[model samples]
Target chain A: MTVKLYIDSIHDALQEEMRRDDGVFVVGEDVGVRGGVFRVTQGLIEEFGEARVIDAPLAESAIVGVAIGAAAYGLKPVAEIQFADFILPAVNQLISEAAKMRYRSNNDWSCPLVVRAPYGGGVHGALYHSQSLEALFHHVPGLKIVMPATAADAKGLLLSAIRDPDPVLYFEHKALYRWIKDEVPEGEYTVPIGKARCVLEGDDITVITYGLMVHHATEAARELEKEGISTELIDLRTVAPLDSEAILAAVRKTGKVLIVHEDNKTGGVGAEVSAIIAEKALFDLDAPISRLCGPDIPAMPFNPPQERFYMLNSEKIAQAMRQLAAF
Target chain B: MMNAQSLEVPAMIAKRHDKLGLTDHDVVKMYHFMLKTRGLDDRMWLLNRAGKVPFVVSCKGQEAAQIGAAFALNPVRDYVLPYYRDLGVVLVFGQTAKDVMLSAFAKQEDPNSGGRQMPGHFGSREHHIVTGSSPVSTQIPHAVGIALAARMKGHNLVAYTSFGEGSSNQGDFHEAANFAGVHRLPVVFFCENNKYAISVPLRKELACEHVSDRAVGYGFPGVTVDGNDPLAVYAAMKEAVARALDGQGPSLVEAMMDRMNPHSSDDDDRTYRSKDELEEVKSHDPILSFRDYLLDCGVLTEASEKALREEVTVEINVATTYAEKAPYPHPEQALRYVFAE
Candidate 1:
């Protein structure tokens, strides 16, 4: 195992997968020659020639629609949407086309396509770039959404996504691209999708989160340990098919639950996690379900104070955990 | 239907068929497909009126363009992403009359969607026809991907896609065309301009004179031909296919025709279109006009024409009965196929 950045882990997955399978190819606006805006696809085009590494036109619908076509054509295409916020333009393709292809065709056709988009806030990307749009996609049944919080899971889940037999929307938090680094395995590892990993085990309070928020929750859990407030942390690797077993198990252990995310508060991913806890683990809950998320403003502000207020950090998450523990 | 054997004007002769390398048998086969498409489509409308099927989107006036274009390509090697009104294209690509009737009936054996999608959403893996959706012009980019795959996989195949003229106004068409042109992929954009998008006139549908003209913005040659003339549309499609195979890039061929019926069974086009206009467009129906052209070439005798009609009618009737009797999929089966097992 070697310590690597989240971005490098994703890049290694693409490079390794392309080397492993001839059917896997990468396509996006600046994926070739320029690596990517976030450098998550660096060094892929150099190893795979231009035919395998494509720079598509600035059309999100075509990028995804063409990827759907290639997937139907029996090729695994890893299409990169530059940012999660810009994904709205291609929602029709993602929802109407890719999501329903298999169900509509009665399994006669399936698009084994991986759409990688960088999501979440805190990088000052403003409205056009720094939005957490996971909620917009999770409700669709035939689609799968994977959000990796650790470098190891980044490499592992992406490998699994490309190999999966259906469309998978892999969202990597842009804020954690270079900021988060962990010991990733040497080669060829997979973190099975729709599963969660327990980062820290305690009995006082349970915190469920994914993407960059997982790091913030981990930091808060570590800080609370020194203060005698025990915290259990579960990083939900995939948001769509919420790891209900793990979530219920953790909630049953702690008797209290707190969900955290960077997306807007109203109708965000945490609401679903909260509802799951309230429904299945209702008898086990010791207190009301609590959630910490971005405020219901349109988006994160560009200014520092407003951005700080709109975002969640270790201090904020620790404060929320402290309150939940006392309750 | 008026049989125009006596009106065999010299100018309406089959002089252009040989020049385009279409044997007499080939044109006859094309006419037969046009006839078959009309037969199947007509039966579906009667089924709709009789309360057997729920909906009907007629392909009345565009048979020549669909049949003409489908015959020009290598159906075995190429990928086709057809839209909702492409009964003629899918028929030529090997979707059987029974398969279509099954789709129309939404039965268990419907190969397209197993009774999931509405009729006209076509797909057949053995026939190399990619499954399509009801959304207009969305299949354009999918065609680009198939063409890109052909080039990448080193396969000698071209990808073909067709849509109504109104679909040309979609951003998907522009984006797909631009991407295909930028990469010089093996693709042919066939637009069956049948003149109406659910009661909106062509004048409101496009700002340009022809749907093919938009291909110039994407760096491709664009041509508009009389869609009622199967030989003319076939000549254009054949040329476009050859150009795509040569790696010269994509081309746009627009077959200009008319909508011989309302947009669908549910629509009342009489509100927007004059009766005279509908009657005028009906006079140029591709299925009828192409049959006359085949007769003028001496390839189709009156007796042979009768034999073809009998053959198509029997085929359609058998398919209709088989689909009408077919069992529906178990309601529980709808829970399956969401993800690969």
Candidate 2:
């Protein structure tokens, strides 16, 4: 097993998928010559020809629209949006065209494509580079939303997403790209979508999270362990078609729940999770379904104090857990 | 007017004969297509009135340009991405009369949509027709990609896309033209300028006199043709397709026509245009002019014309009955085809 980072897992998964399936190819700005801005697609143009590793114009909407058509035609295309924030330009295609193609057309067509983008705050990438918009996509039907928090999950989920017949938005947390590392499988393997994993098992309150927030949630759980909190941590793999079964089971055992994510509090995935708990496992809850989320703002600021205040962190998760346990 | 003043029409008509290179047989086939399309359009209106088909967009006056483009291509070879108004093109491209009628009735047998889509939303994977969404101008870039794919495969096959003048104002149109022109892909961008987008007139939409003129900005040959004249429209489409097949690049051909009906079954045309304007549009009807031309050229006799109309009437009746009898798609089908699974 190779100890690889999350970004490295993306590169390996893409290279392996491209080698395995002739129909699979990668397309986006700087994906060819530049190996992607984050270099997740490094050495791909060399391994696969330029046709397989296409470098498209900077037009975001064209990148998305072309991928949809190409996927419809025959080829399985994976388009990279350089930054998750910049994906707003192509949101029309994602929301209206790609997402609706399968449903509105009554399955006469399927947009079997992947749109990969780096998201999250920290690493000093201010404003447009750091927004978490997975919640926006998770609300839309006909699209699978993936946010990997580990190298292994990244590789497995990437492979699964590439092979999935439906359109998927694969959000790679830029903060976790190199910071988080794990032993990824050497060959082909895929983790099914809509499944969560127990990062840590405990008897006290359960902390459910994903993406970069998973790290913070884990850290919070570790710190709480010394105080005998014994927190159970669950890392959700895909937000849409979420692992509600796993979550409810965890909540039933731990008898308490605290949902955390990097996205804003208003209309975020946390609220949806809270609602799911209320609907299914309400009586099992020891306290209210607490949520630790980013402030209701666009994104984190460049200023250290303001940025730290805007985004959710380990301390916030720890504090939220303490408050929930007290209740 | 003299035939010479018509520039391309008479010459193009004389160049090809029966059974090959768009012969008299092909012309009659196209005429048959027009009859079928008009029959379907008329049936749709009746269905809507009778509350059988929920909605319909009748491509009545615009049949010539739509059918002409369809006649110019082999459906198995070429890909067509057309807007809602090209119901005639859908028929000419081998979408069955029954399939179209079933789609209008929202039945399981509707090959285009299988009861999921609105009327006139045509898409067929078997014929390589890319599924069209309700969003205007989104199909343009997809057509460009098809052309690009053809070039990538080193094939001479061309991808054809048609939309109205209203869609030309969209940014996707420019993106498609730019990509196709810059890449030198095999595509013919056909814009059927019916002079209105829903209720908005062409003059209010664009400052340019013709939509084709916008194509010059993208470094391709752009020409405007009399869309009401099937021969002229066919000639222009043939030239564009030939240019693309010869590896020259893409071309934009604007076919100027008029919409004789409202935007759709739900729209009321009388609310927007005056009686005189509607009458003027009717005078330039493509089907009438083409029939007159066929009569003058001795290609069609009065008896044959009457017989053809009756034949189309019978065919339409049969298709309607078939559509009405087709079962509704099972609700479990809702989960099916959401993916390739």
Candidate 3:
């Protein structure tokens, strides 16, 4: 195992996958010599020629649309949308074209493509640079959404996403790029999609989250231990096809549930998680299911005070856990 | 297929085909596909009116442009991403009359989408006709991507995509063209300028005089040709294809045609179009003009024309009957194909 930053693990996945499959190519803005906006695709251009690592024009729709077309032509294309907020321009391409390619064609054609973008707030990126838009794509049927909270999961999940037979939207929390590091396996350790990982197993209160929130929740859970409250934590690696088996099992173990996310509360993925828990595990709950998400404001502001208010921290999560633990 | 038309072509008309590397048989085949497209389109409209089909998007006046450009493509080696009114293009590329009918009838056996999408949403993996959606100009970038793939794979192929003049104004068109131009991808952007985007006229669609003129901003050569003359359209497409294959970059070929009918069966031309303009469009119908040209060249006689017309009608009728009797997909099938099993 090699100790690597969360972003390097993702870079290793792309470089390794390109070496493994000639059909795989990269396309995005400044993904070439400039690597990516976050250097996630650094050195890919030098390793594989410009043909494989394309520095695409500044058009999100075309970036994803071209990837969809390349996927249709039997090529594995990894498209990057620079930022999750800028991905709105490609919503139609992902929802209408990429997601519907196989279904609309009745299985005659399929798009094996990956659109990776960095998401989440707390980096003072204001509105455009920092926004979690996974729920928008999570609502789509044919598209799969994944947000890994660790370097190891990031590498494994990214490899699986690229090799998956359908389109996948990979959202990386920009805050975890260099702040987080973990021991990553050397080669070929793809964590299967549509599965949730259990973290900090306990029996007092249940906390379900993914992406950057997973780390914050872990820190919060560790602090809750000092208060003699055991927290059952789950990191949902794949958000679309939720790992209901693990989630229900976790909820059944602990009677209370608290869903955490950096995205907004109204119509967020937390709502879907809440619905699922309420549907099957409602009877098992000792208290009402609660959701700790960003406020209903349009987006996180750039100011320090408002940004702190708009963002979720381990302290805020610990308070929610304390409240849930008390119940 | 090379019977009287191949031998009886006059010297003047033979030069038209020879200069473009097309044989008399090829043009005859083009004519046949155009007729079949028109017959099937008319049949679908009739079915819609007769309460059999739900909707109809007629390819009435655009047949010449569709078939003409399709003749220049390498159907087996290349990919063609056609728009809604591209029945003629799909027919030329290998979709049979029965396939078109099955889509129109939305039967379980429909190869395009198993009766999922609308009839004009044509797709066939066997024929390399890439699946398309209802959104306009989205296929332009897809075609560009296909070309990019071919180039990366070191394959000598061109990707052809067609859209209406109105769709040329879409952002997808501009982004796709700029991307293709920057990469110098091997793709041909064929714009069938049918003069209308539903009820809106071309004058309001763009500030430019022609759709081809917009290609200059994308760093590619753009040319416009008469859509009524199949030979002219074929020549332009052939040149574009040659440039793409030679790695000179992409080209935009715009073919000027009429919408003929209303925007669709649900539209009312009387509400928007004038009778004088309609009469002028019909006076120079592409089918009639091509027939006259063939007759003057001694390639098509009145007797052969009657026989061909009857043949097309019979094929369309048989396809309609077969597709009409075909069963619809089971209700449970709607949930399928959402993800790969």
Candidate 4:
């Protein structure tokens, strides 16, 4: 039995990786002394020295660039951006250099670096703080984008991401950092990239989601069960190398599909999944595919009504399932 | 790799030919390389004009400095992370003129691109030259990275990367220099300050007196050399490379050369600058000054100089022809070279 382990999974992953490998080090603003704003890196500086738990200058590009350099030089660096929004400054390093290094160099050099950032909405992080920008990274090839929904998966995926040969952007939803916890293996384990897990299996309507939205979808699935509508909830563990087979199978069985993400409605991961379904399994669909996501403009405000309206919740997921089931 | 001690002084003087170098062979080689580079530049410009090639960032005025720097290290070992305007440096680092021409032509036979990259995006694994990209100052950190790798591997090899004055404005430049200094990596950050970034003057881009002065802030030794004088540039690079190899750390050396050509084939200087300004810079061309120094040293006689120019012209002409005749890459091959399977 997977015993319920209620702890900071990200912190657990960091501790495990740091202990497991000599090269594994964490570097970020306030990550060392302050233990990060959310305390994800708490007690790491005490465990490992300052060199391993580096307190870098407040330069995102430098942080990413230095990590790339360190990784190429044979150190496994887990660099954290205090917030996901501030990752823009280092976008070029991540997108251009880190992504294309292996491809352009013909695999002469591989950047085995992991950039961990706390992302997604629901903590009243506002515009600058809360953002589901995984789609932006998902669009770029040669990069692996992982957004773990569960505590167990978070530890496994974070470890795998650290060990992976290519650069991995491990986007940790700030909402799920401590809000949701389950049995995460105490020993070393890895969840394969490009594999989606059916967290809750049903056959009526398939709801594809990832990260914090997975929990939301599960809530919606339970609510739908009360109405005799069995919903299949899939958590897309890795966004970039998506598990098309799993998605195709789910669609084939359920004959109906609803893609949900915390990102903006237009051009979200749902759009890509929709396109993939259209391209591959259009005939398998029983009804038109639907997407439940934040309204497309920018991240919404912290106001109770505006936040409730703009953010996608279990209610929104249930609404989509009802509409899809009715069709 | 060749013995560093034997090549150090000669290579240094070869790099900065007008300085107090007592060697005649070094000056002659400097003249030869400059002439060779200038010839290639002239051919490439004509190729662009004649519609045989698409684009070029000519290294005509910066040959002496580029070649002198190239001569400072063993081409077989030290890795060079060159920029678009570093054709001369690329050639000196063991890339064939034909290979570079084919790259410019975007042919399937182009070693640099394999028909994937645009013209002047040069790279050669055989030459230990890391691939060049269009992004400004991106290679600065990569060079430091390679140096860091070499240092970790316990190989005393140095990484040399060069870019224009414009590239110094990039945040990557600052980051790479800072990290290299902090880690004491064996890397040389060569800033080819040609006074103008395209049409944007150095004054508009930088408030500092020279590009090298910024190195002091990064906690490394910085020096400004007469980039037009290959001897001075070579001397500076040798000193820097030696310091790095001896585990001293990275150093920044600004080569104050001239931007004789417009920023690239796509750019026209006449749109932004007067002919007077163009002529003023052209008068101090590195190739011309190096040629004069060779003549003074009696290393390059009129007959020899004529023969050398003819030889280089023919070599470049043959390369141009080979590039033109080379087949364009197949449409399906576009996705081939992105990564190694």
Against the native complex, each candidate's DockQ, computed on alpha carbons, is 0.84, 0.55, 0.87, 0.38
- Could you estimate the TM-score for every candidate? 0.97, 0.95, 0.98, 0.89
Which residue window of length 10 is worst by lDDT in model 3 chain B? B6-15
lDDT by residue (tens digit), candidate 2, A13-58: 9998989987888878899989999999999999998877888877
Question: What tens digits encode model 4's per-residue C-alpha lDDT throughout B1-341?
Answer: 34453276553223224344536676676677778778878888888999877788778788888988887877877888888888778888887778878877878788776766666677777777776678888878778767765664567888898989999999989988887887787889999988888889888999989888899888899999989888788889989989988999999989998888888888998998899988998899877777776665456777898998888888888998888898987887656534335
lDDT of 1: 0.90
Error of 4 at A283 (Å): 3.3
Model 2 spans with C-alpha error above 4 angstroms = B1-20, B150-156, B331-336
Angstrom error of the Cα, residue B341, model 1: value is: 1.2
**For model 3, what is the alpha-carbon lDDT of residue A311?**
94
Writing each residue's lDDT as its tens digit, candidate 3 over B174-290 gives 999999999999999999998999989988998989899998999999999999989899999999999999999999999999988888889989898899999999987898888
Query: In candidate 2, residue A147 scores what lDDT?
Result: 90
Q: Kindly report which residue pairs in candidate 3 clash with one another.
A: none
Q: Which candidate gets the maximum DockQ versus the true structure?
A: 3
Q: Is the docking of candidate 1 incorrect, acceptable, medium or high quality?
A: high
Pairs in clash, predicted candidate 1: none
DockQ of candidate 3 (2 decimals): 0.87
- Deviation (Å) of A100 in candidate 2: 2.9
Q: Over all chains combined, what TM-score does candidate 4 have?
A: 0.89
- Per-residue lDDT tens digits of candidate 2, residues B1-341? 55543455553333332323666677777888888888899889998999988899878899998988787777878889888888888777778888888988899988787888888777887776778878888888878777765655565688889899999988788877877787677889999999989889987988989998998898999999998877778788888988998989999999999999999888998998999999999898888888876766667788888888898999889999998998999989877765455
Deviation in angstroms for B292 in model 1?
A: 1.6
